[model samples]
Target: MPVYEFRCQACQRKSSFFVRSIGGSLSPACTACGSREMSRVISGFAYHKSMATIHEESGGPDRPGSDYYKDPRNIGRWTEKKFKDLGMEMPSQIQEMIQSAREGEMPESVKDLQPNLTDV
Candidate 1:
């Protein structure tokens, strides 16, 4: 089961519910205001660990005491593998985007939105 977050428009309260399927519709009622007008928000998952944490927890990979850094190709490989696992075709644009990121060149689409990291 997956958890989904929802915000009540009437009372402005947020709640989370475990949903069996992503396609299922949720009740719009607000727990506080009893209003049937609520909006769904992106929910966070608590049960899973991130890739970096998983790597660290596994004793830094096969070589003991060696720092375990993710392979630069891992992202592209994972992206391709995920599509294969889902029985879906990988889009060429996504492949290109991963390639560009690996090459350290920001994609033209998001170039203008780059943040100024020097600014605190």
Candidate 2:
């Protein structure tokens, strides 16, 4: 389940709701004025820590898009152009594993561990 923030236009009230995905946004009628003219706010939920926060908590590898990647010592010997020249197709699972690692969640399997070898 995911929590979403919605704002009521009629009463100018904001509320958060834990909703099941019903294939669309959960913009309900205003609880105060009963107006269907509510507009969903794009932000304001703090239910979970962000990826950076999670990385800080785990004390894991450096963040992917940080200044660390800009260092010459951190640069990969084979660049993206080299991989493209090799005609390599990045596996979807490897992509997902890299994403997970970036979020500080390392999967405990041989295949999942491969991405950890690369500089996140």
Number of the predicted model whose TM-score against the real structure is largest: 1
Error of 1 at 26 (Å): 2.3
Model 1 alpha-carbon drift over 4 Å, by segment: 45-120
What are the TM-scores, per candidate, against the unseen true structure?
Answer: 0.36, 0.35
Model 2, range 13-41, lDDT digits (tens) per residue? 87666667856666577667777776767
RMSD of 1: 16.2
User: lDDT winner among the candidates?
Assistant: 1
| lDDT of candidate 1 over 1-120, digit per residue (tens) | 666667888888987677777787667566677877778886554244345556566442233222222343333554566578889997888778767756765566533232232441
**Candidate 1, 64: how far from true, in Å?**
17
Off by over 4 Å in 2: 22-27, 46-120
Score candidate 2 by lDDT: 0.54
